[model samples]
Target: MALKYVEEYRDGTLARDLVKKIHSVSKKKLRLMEVCGTHTTSIFRHGIRSVLPKGITLLSGPGCPVCVTAQKDIDAFVAFARVKNVIVTTFGDLMKVPGSSSSLTKEKACGADVRIVYSVFDAVNIARENKDKEVVFCGVGFETTIPTIAAGILMGIEGKLDNFSIYSANKLTPPALAALMETDGVQIDGFILPGHVSVITGTDAYRGTFEKYDIPSVIAGFEPIDILQAILLLIQQNEAGKPALENAYPRAVSHAGNVKAKQIMNQVFEVCNASWRGIGQIPSSGMELKKEYQRFDAAIKFAMDMPDVPEPKGCACGQILMGLKTPEECVLYKKKCTPMNPVGPCMVSSEGSCAAFYRYS
Candidate 1:
């Protein structure tokens, strides 16, 4: 048999059948927001848009982690990299994302001691060994990755590593979705929700995106058939006039999510107001390391003074994140910005809007 959601979900015949069904049932023009970065990548990678009905419009939201990271956050990360005897640690995606003046990659090339790690735990290990230098993890992620950071914090606490700290840019998904729904630039009939984030945060987290806005949400998987099936589910909901959450990826997600991981996150992080790259400060959407984890807070340890972040000149990343424009609409998209040298994080992250647009179509 096929490997559950993996092989079974990618079935070409199933995808074709579902797409045909979507076309047959969907008579009116509908705007659906795929509120996950992976969905954006998959839509492009699979050429799903090519065969889609002209009435159905898929809008990419503020889902990509690196793209949503504000300019001030980048400045804060690079500021840490510039300090003497400080070992800056981050995931690979953060290295190329541009700050106001520079990026972590440029600092690394200049021998600024930037190290890439698989997880936050790897950063803690560096702090244990490199006693002479302070190790700061340039942590960036959404709900799916926050639990990993929480796990690392637990490890750090158990080991009592004094030298280790994390500069977390962690965020929740729903509030940003709510923010988008409130804005005039976006209007959607349904949402193809993210699968991975649902594993930790669960189906309950998406209820607000539906109940308040009256939009149907289908928590979708990465594969071709899975996405198509979710669209069908949305069409069914739209016809019935019911805006509800249906977990299409039932294998990994549940109504209640991972309780143990949520506990770990609750212990270390508290919700706080935070800014996004294109979007301004969204109230109580971001997580800050709590009072109990003060010793591990790199923002306090470094005393970084990053100014209020500014948008890049003529960059449509903000508009793109708000669903007002696509990457193709940006003047600087391919002219001044590219994968290698991105003026904005949308070009920097592989999951980023511009990168996905350029790569797939």
Candidate 2:
């Protein structure tokens, strides 16, 4: 049964069949945006881009959480590292992301208390162990990771760990998708939706946006067959002149997502205006600690006031995220902005389109 399951999804025969079907149905040139960082990585890892027809252009949207996090938020994290007796904790990817002036790694090298944590609960534990020091977690993610962060706050509160707080830069996936639709000069025929985010927000969360824009969207898993199937579905919809939102990854996603997780996220955080690294501020796209949960807000606790710093000059990360430009088109790409020294967040993040392109292409 296990062998059948793996072969069913990853079988060469199935993937080739889907690709042939896609090529047969696809007559018109179409632009499809994959709105998840992991999808971008998977597509590259599986060499899906090379197999696709030249008529079908796949663009990577604002999928990387670390890539989309605004420069101001990075600065705030760096600010925490500079504070005396304060422990700044964040995911490993965030440690290399440069702020307006410096990065967490640089701060740590300068004798600051910066730590890389795998989870928010680990930061909470650090706070619990060191009562004399303040532990601030740099929270940067989308719907897929927000619920766990919310639960960690509740855990801290229950344990009476007052020293723990979070500088939330969490973004909502549906809102970003809506924002992309409204962007000028952006043309997307279909949306290859994210599987993980859909598992949290569900197919219903994308209904309003799909109804408004009337774009064909398919929530797909990470497997090669799964992506190829989604592409075939998108081609069929475009050929029939029908635009609808559908879930291709039914085994993992549903109409109604994890209800308890949503409740916990709502209990701890509220919607606010959020700044995207290259896309600017999208209203009600960011998550912040609620009024009752203000005690756990790291920005509030540290009195952090980050400056409105602009992105790196000549970096086309914003345009790349919006599908207006590809990473190869960027002047900084491969010249000055390699993975070792990324000029923009797109190169720094593992899920970033630029990073995938560099690795695969």
What do the candidate models score in CA lDDT, each in turn?
Answer: 0.87, 0.92
Residue 25 shift from truth in candidate 1, angstroms: 1.3
Supply the TM-score for candidate 1. Answer: 0.96
- So what's the TM-score on candidate 2? 0.97
lDDT of 1 by residue, 137-245 (tens): 9878898989889888888888878778888888889998888888885777888999999999999988866788878899998888878888888888887777778
Report the poorest 10 consecutive residues by lDDT, candidate 2.
1-10
Regions of model 1 farther than 4 Å from truth: 1-4
Q: After aligning candidate 1 to the native by TM-score, how far in Å is the CA of 172 from where it should be?
A: 0.7
Residue 347 in model 1: shift from native, Å?
1.2
The lowest-lDDT stretch of 10 consecutive residues in candidate 1 is: 1-10
Clashes of each: 0, 0
